[model samples]
Structure formats: C-alpha cells, structure tokens
Target: MFVWLTQFILFRLAFGMALLLSTDLLASKQLALNSQTADFPVVSYCVDPDWLPYEAIRNNQHVGMSFDYMTYIGVLAEINFSLIKTESWSETLDKLKNGECQVASMLNRSPEREKYLLFTRPFFVGANVLVSNVDQPFLQGYENIGEQVLGTVANYRQAEYIKNYYPNIKLKLVDTELAGLKSLASGDIDLFVGSLLSINAQIQKSGFSNLRIAGIAEPQDILGMGVANGDQVLLKKLDTAIAQLPEWVHVDIYKQWNNVRVIDEIDPRYIFGGIGVFICLIIIGIWWQLIIRRYNGKLVAKNSQLQALQNELVEKNRRLEFMSMRDPLTSMFNRHFMQDRVEQEKQVSLRTNVPLCLILIDIDYFKAVNDQHGHVVGDLVLQEIATIVCSTIRDMDVAARWGGEEFIVLCPNSNLDDAIKLANRLKDAVSGFDFNTVGHLTCSFGVAQHYAKESFVEWFDRADKALYTAKDTGRNTIIAAK
Candidate 1:
C-alpha cells in the first residue's frame, strides 16, 4: 500500500509541473509576438488603474469598456494576453517608448500624434460634457452655468481648449475623473467636465444621491486607441474587430450613458396664469397686506441680484475679448492681434513722422531641445524667453509670437539705436538663463528701423535678412540692418 501511494503522488506532481510549463510558454509567446510585430512591436497596453466605466482594475483583473474590448480582441485572435496597468498617463506613454507597453487605449485621434503612433479605427464615440449636482438649478445651456468653476483632468487636451477659449470661466483641474467628481461634491468645483459616458458611469457607481448627470455638450472631440508606430497588423486587426461589432451594440452603449436630465421650458400663457392665480390666492389670505409686501420684497431682491449678475457678465465678456488678443503661452499679444496693433502704429508713425522699427527673434536650436528633452521642457524654455523679452522692452513696444519659436517686436517711434539696444538686452538675458533640462541657450535677433517709404513687407524683409546674418555669424547675437 505504501509503494502504491508513493507512485500516485509522483504522478500528480508531474502533471502539475506540465500544466505550469504550458502556462508559462503561452505567456512567453504572447510577450514575444507583442514585441516583434511592428516598429513598436512590443506593445504595452497602458491604462489608468482607478478609472472606472472606461478602464480600471477590479480584484486584480483588468475590466471596463476598453478592457472588455481588448480582451475580446485577444480571444478572437487566439493569442494569450498579458495586460499592464499604469496609474498615470505619462507613465503609460513612457512604457510604450521604453518598449514595455506597446499600445495606449482610448486616446483622442489627433494629427499631431500620428507622427509617432499608429491609430486604429474608432471603436467608440465620446463627447465632452458638463456634470453638476442634482440639487442645483438645472443648466438650460452652458451659458446658464455662468461663472461656476468647471473641473477637468490635468494634462488633458480639453483643459487646454477651455483655458484658451473661455479664460473668464473658472477652471479647476484634478488628476482623475474621480477626483473631479469629489471636488464637485465638496464644493471645491462647481461642475466637473469630462467624457459623458465615463463620467456618467462613475457617478452611477459612486451612489452619490445628490449628484446628477447634466445634459451632454456638443462633442468637441472623439476618443480612439493608439498603437506604437508601424504596427499595421495590429491596426488592421483592430479595424476589423471594430467593424464586426454591430451598430446596435453602439446604440446600447449610448443608451446606458445618455442620463442627462433636461427640463422643458414652461409655456408663456401657463406661466402668466399661474402667477395671476398665486397673486389672487395671496390677496384672499388673512394677512394679505403682509404677504404682498414680503412677496414684493423677495421679487425686488431677486431682480436686483439678476441685474448685478448681468452687469458682471458684460464686464467679463469685455475682459475675455481683450484677453483673446493675448497668447496663453507668452501672455504677449498674439500674431494676428499684433497685426491690428501694427496697422494702428503705422497711422501713428505717419502722423508723427517717426520711424517704426521691427525686431524678429528666434530661439536658437529650439527644435533640438524639444527632441532631446521633450515638448514640455521646450514649452517652458519658450515661456522663460518670452518673460525675459517682455521685461526688457518698453511698455509702448509690442512683442508677439510670429509663428513657432519666433517672436516679433514692434517698436513704434523708435529708431535703430533704441531697437539695437533693446535687441542686445534681449539676447543677453535669454543667454544668461539656464532652462532646466535644456540648460543655457541663446537666441538670434534681427533689428530693422523702418525707412520712410518702405512697405511693411520691405521692412519685415530687412529684419528677416538681418536675422539670417545673426544666425550665420553664430547665434546668441543681435544684427541690425545697415
């Protein structure tokens, strides 16, 4: 009996070992194929760990809309799957570059990203929306939201859009949609802005009775997946998978998220009748005089409050119009706005018979910094140089972005000496500063004092010509038109 038992135990151990070996072999195969398949052959599927209704991990298992979609693809292709989860968007992107993760799910389709990543046919449609508490007054439209603080995710494209176009509207950024909703509930933010479906699912799961899903805004953008560049096979497979999904499936998904509550405007005749009936009912009460006086007082207060808000809105609009002329990156007047100012300056220059000078500044090797350090650091360098230049120039002088990595300054009523001096100061200041990862850098400047009979193009050409001279002479110097 003892000999028989020993033999059975050995057989069981062998079987278990074989099973383990098979599992490891499948996993290894999946990893190998993920790496060898494209330019970025090693695809890492990077996803936010805590984001629910879109992508999330629950009980150590990847799950959500995107997770389900990926899982389906893996099964259909008969490939064993290995999923990687990341807590931050940047880490996901890093993993893809480091050959750790090969694919990013549910990214916005953008022409700019096409340079580095391969995109699949869109699997789903998403719309940006404004979400608010149920207890608050319903949003008839975005305009009705007024100056309420809108919450959005940090480092998100939508945040940048709102920042640029609606500067007067209050914007608050949290790291995640969960945090955005938390801020809204805590009164830190008035409304949370995000993808309608994702935010709706989150709100539903939170079980926050007071919170509500407001009407979705017009979809400003769409979301899609990104694979590492040159993954044509994977891209084609994704396209096929998406095409296979029936139209009803998409409709069902949309139906689940279209939780936006809309209120219909009351008919004018009904409103008038209702108000008259309420007045008559109050008049017939025992304390009729007192009721009427209190009612009128409340109406007056509400009217005055609305009037004040209207005036404030008008003022905010005026400020927005003024700020529209400014660049968000540099806080200087932007190129198009500067053109209008230049025309005005031309009128003034002609009236006073004074010269109008132009200086064109280009940061040397700006693209190199971007390639070496990253776009974020390059943006910081541009901001730093803009600050230095703005500080060096007189208040009357106009500085503006003349396209990428180039700045144009219009010096009205200033001749060659003033332009050259200012240009030299700018060159020195930019060269002296160490730009974080980029380190110390320099800029080239071309200074041109206008000739009385010169056309705008002629004056600009002279400045541009001098700029080339500065570049040719080795950058970090100022060149003035002779």
Candidate 2:
C-alpha cells in the first residue's frame, strides 16, 4: 500500500511539473511566432575573449556558460546569434558601443554601459571573491583592504565600483583576470578581485598555486545579455526567452561547465525499500495517535498555560532589552548602544572611504541648574535638551545621552565642516529654547571628524579636548578639533 502511495505522489508531482513546462513552452512558442512575424534579424554578439567558464572565445568560436545559454535562448526565440569576435574584453565593449555588435553575450549592468546597451533579465548569478598571494592573511571583505594595492580587470564593474566608492585604496588595472592573478603571483599587485567562477577557472587553468581566495567581495555578479541601445524588440525577445528557459536546463549547463557530476536516475530497489519503511512508520504513528488521544485534553490545558508563560517571558525580555539600551530620563540611546554604533560606523567609514564625524555636546551650568532649581527641574531640562537635539540633527545622525549632562551625536558621511555646522545648529537650538522654570539654557559643542585608522579612544579624546576648549573659551560655543 505504501509503495502504491509513493508511486501516486511521484506521479502527481511529475504531472504538475509537466503541466508547468507545457505552459512555459506554449508561451515561448508564441514569442517565437511573434519574432517570426516581425522577421527579427540575426543578432551580432560580442564576448570577453579571455573570460572562461562564464564565457570566452577559442578557435574562433563562442564558448562557455553564456554560449550555452544563448544557444538555447536563440532556439526558443527563433533568433540567431552570430559571434563578432574580439581579441580582448575592452575591444568587445568598443564593438558594442560602436554598433559592431548588436548584443554583449554576458555582462553586469552598469550606468556607463546602460548609455549604450539595454540589458535583459539576469541569466547568471554568482558571488565575487578577493584573490591574493597564499601568504596573505584572510581579509574579512573588500572593506578591510586598507592601503593594499587592489587589481581589477579594466572596464569590469568591480573596478568601476572601487573607483567610485573606495577611492582611497590604490587601484591597479589589468587587462584580464589571468593577468591580474599573474600580477598577484609575481608580487606586483597585493590583491585581485573577480567572480568566483572565473577566478577558480583561471587559477586552475593557469596552475597558479600561489594564489588563494582572500575574501568575498562587496557585490555578487548579476550577468545578462546586453542588447545595443535602440534594440528594444531584441531586448524584449531575449528577456522572454530567458524567463521561459527551463530550470533543469540551467542546472545542466552549470553542472557541465563547473565539472559537477550529474546523476541521471535513482535506484528502484531503494525507492521500494524506502516506501516499505514509510509504511511501517505510518502504522506506528496511528498506534501512537490512539495513545496520545487519551491524554489530549490534559496536554492541551498544559500547553495553553505554557504558551501564556512563554508570552509573558518574551514580553519581559523585550522590555529588559529596551531598558538596557535606553536612558530612563531622556528616553534617548544610552552610552552602551552608541559605543556599538560608533564602532560599526567607523568600519563603514573605513571601508567606503566616506567621512564620519562626532560631536560631543555638554550642557553648560547643569550642576548649578540642579543646585538652584532642584533635580526635578534638572531632569526636565535634560528631557527638553534631548528633544532639541533630536529636532536639530538629520534623521541619519544618531544621538545618545552620554551620561549626566552630556550627549554625543554620531554623524556618518559628514565631513569636519558639515559636522561643525551641525554642532552650531544644535548649540543655537539649545540656547534659544525656553526651559520654563529653568528659563533658558545653553550647550557647548566639540566637533571632530574621524581620522582614518584612528582608534575609538583617540577619536573620542580629541573631541573631549575640544569640548574643554569650548568650556574655557566661554560656554555655549562650538569648537572644532584641528
């Protein structure tokens, strides 16, 4: 009986999958018919002549995963792809830009490329990795490559990203992934970046025993065929073809190129034995169900009580977590939370080469306010100042009550000038506000931009010294750390 049930389940699954495939094929056929009616011309395509496993040109023929995918897509769309070979990837880009080729066989989409090409849906996705000499330490990611000379393929998206976002790092451009790896092996470049697939393929093909994967890169690769700008009809057809391609076809092509073994069939004897075991388990489950039913009511009541207790504990834990991170008086983030956030922001600043700034603001004459007006009024003054600080700073800035009568604001992506301007605005807001019973109060600010490779303790010390200067020069003024 279990054997029969297993067979019935497999039949149903196969039938559903068949119906889905039939629907996809019918849609693909309609697209083909449309292309036939339109008389879509043969597409002249270009490819990186050296990139392998993903794509390459050899013996005057297109090859690799992109070639296989395009071959299948061309048949489904009733179109043809004619190879327009180039000697290098740079030449391929020129061909696409010059209209020598109507399609780029595979590439990542970028704003610069978008000017000359219309991209189809991504047909291949893979993570990128950092490659370095085997003696190098394992880096966490691209963000940790401080001061290292990084090499990337010229005109590749990774090079573009590093230039645009991480300009502080020295960049060395190579003509190909193989060249980059060779450069690293010879100690000419400190690191190289490329997609995991092509990187592995090149390392293995070139027998580069000295190179190792140092770390994962920032963004994963999203590759698709690029149609030349103004080729809307070809773009639409390619998109449809890619979307309709069967999942198994993609799996098969990937496995073939990656040298992964494919099992064609499962053993019938194992299937029968598995079904017999399942039947035995079902019989035991039915017997167990009868015993469980005898105590079902009692178990249900106990479960309800346990659920109520669990809910209460979860609520209590949430409140505890909130209390731990927040100041009770001002309801602002406490020092502990700010410490963690500052560390995270500093790492981001280092990684992206973006500027970060810190502003240390101290309420002036706070001890006098408490001594003169009592702690209740002092508490209200703190709350009112917190409100002003929140209102004065941009939403991206994080403000925390840094112990009694002091606060800290962490400004990400802000330079020294911008941070000082923000600090002045905050100081003005505090001095102008009426505290009711306390009348008017003022705040002194010390603003400092984070220096590259500076420790958190050193960064904070600079800001603190500037605050002392502000207090000495006269309270309620802003002083920027030099």
Clashes per prediction? 6, 0
Weakest 10 consecutive residues of candidate 2 by summed lDDT: 1-10
lDDT of 1 by residue, 1-482 (tens): 23322432353343334333545543443345434323222235777666556777777666666664564344234333456867776666677666576677667644445556776556664555667775566454356668878888875666766666677777888888888888888878888877655665565545344566554443233455677755767766665656454444455444443433222345698778668857877778656656668877986785565445444433433344334456877777777567655655664466357788999999999999999988999888888888888898986687998878999999987989998888888888888888788789999999998776677888889999999999999998899987
> Which runs of model 2 end up more than 4 angstroms from their true locations?
1-40, 260-482
On TM-score, the candidate that comes out on top is: 2
TM-score per model over all chains: 0.41, 0.49
lDDT of 1: 0.67
Tell me the tens digit of each residue's lDDT in model 2 across 122-240: 77766677887866676766778988899999999999888888989899999999889999999998999988777776655555656667776765576888888568788778878
Error of model 1, residue 425, in angstroms: 69
The runs of at least 3 residues in candidate 1 whose Cα sits more than 4 Å from the true structure, single-residue gaps closed, are 1-43, 75-81, 97-99, 111-115, 134-145, 248-482
Pairs with backbone N, CA or C atoms under 3 Å apart (clashes), candidate 1: 35-41, 35-42, 43-101, 43-102, 44-101, 44-102
Error of 2 at 63 (Å): 0.4
Q: After superposition, how far is residue 437 of candidate 1 from its true place, in Å?
A: 74
